[model samples]
Target: MKAKIHVSAAILATLCVISFFSITLLVELFGTLDQVAWIKSIIVFPGLFILIPAMAITGATGASLAKHRKGRLIQEKQKRMKIIAANGLLILIPSALVLHYWASLGQFNLAFYTVQVLELTAGFINASLMIMNANKGRKLAHK
Candidate 1:
């Protein structure tokens, strides 16, 4: 049951992270936030509503699974998870806030672009780390 929850949460979290990345990319490609302000606002709703809870579930289930595993492998996974959480808190969340704030105020200048880029970069990093963690968890589960 724990493994099922852990894997499911991790998978869902990965999908949410990827969705964030894709949306950021689409916004960038579309060029000019003014053109797609509505899209950004719509995306923000899901990001806030879905991604946050998914991340929480991922962390909780991951910790539960880690408690059962023993040795250096578990320790390493824990370390990576910590980094992932830190990245989300420090980089992704803040960037999202900055983007939203600037966008809401109709400020889509260099600052907004910079924040968007930061958000995208952090999102990709989080996604990559989550993928690695998921692979490690899969191995640990089958062992």
Candidate 2:
């Protein structure tokens, strides 16, 4: 249950970021073309699919570790959060770097910058939430 929650939280956060950039790009450039918006959703799936499973697995591991944390579990919770964030960032880095290179090659404009910022902020918020959820689970486990 904790693992599932962690993954869901992480995925939700990541997707929120993706959705923000995509929807903003579409609305600004594409002007809400109904079909195109749908396409944007499709574009998100590949990342989502890749991330969801990994997060789930990581979260499961965290849950298992939590069981072992026993008395001084808060320390373990912090450790797990750091691990999860690092791993998640590792998963994200390659695609982000590639996308950065591509964007540089494309010479995109201010809107693109705004979209990137939005996406990054959203992603951070999401990752934070995932950690928070994991902590919440830890607290629950303690009780």
Candidate 3:
């Protein structure tokens, strides 16, 4: 149980770090709005090095959590995650709007931004559920 907490926290922490850089890239994208040449979108290429590990660790954590717990608690955790994830989608709407409408942002290279988008998208959604589940686990642990 302690291990799970530590691991979850680590994963969430990593997610937060990823979110930070993704935002940095977004702001840079926005700043470059007027000058965002199409070919520069290729710059997103290198960032995937960070994105892939984040994804794999996140997936592995989920798999491990499920393997570690076998009962109604896991089911409850999963159910809560589903609900939070739905709300998490709402979190992205604003981002989508900013990315799509704001003239400066729209001018930026889509491919260059795609890496940031995917990182932020997955990080936000996964972190939301992971945190929620972690909190739920804490409350249950107290009982």
Best by lDDT: 1
Which of the predicted structures, 2 or 3, would earn the higher TM-score when compared with the native? 3
After superposing candidate 2 on the true structure, give the runs of residues whose Cα lies further than 4 Å from its correct spot: 1-47, 54-105
Number of backbone collisions per candidate: 0, 0, 0
**TM per model?**
0.88, 0.37, 0.42
Model 1, stretches more than 4 Å misplaced? 31-35
What global local distance difference test value does model 3 have?
Answer: 0.51
What's the residue-level lDDT of 55 in candidate 3?
Answer: 42
> Across residues 25-50, which tens digit of lDDT does each residue of candidate 2 receive?
56546563454334334444564566
Q: How far out, in Å, is residue 117 in model 3? A: 9.2
lDDT of 2 at 135: 64
The better-scoring model by lDDT among 1 and 3 is 1
Where model 3 places Cα greater than 4 Å from the true spot, the runs are 1-30, 34-46, 76-124, 137-143
lDDT of 3 by residue, 1-143 (tens): 74565456446544644454455556565755543322123223333344345444544565565775667777877686565445334543334434444433454556536744664665566556666766766665565
Name the better of 1 and 2 by lDDT.
1
The ten-residue window of minimal lDDT in model 1 covers 34-43
Ranking of all predicted structures according to TM-score, beginning with the best and ending with the worst: 1, 3, 2
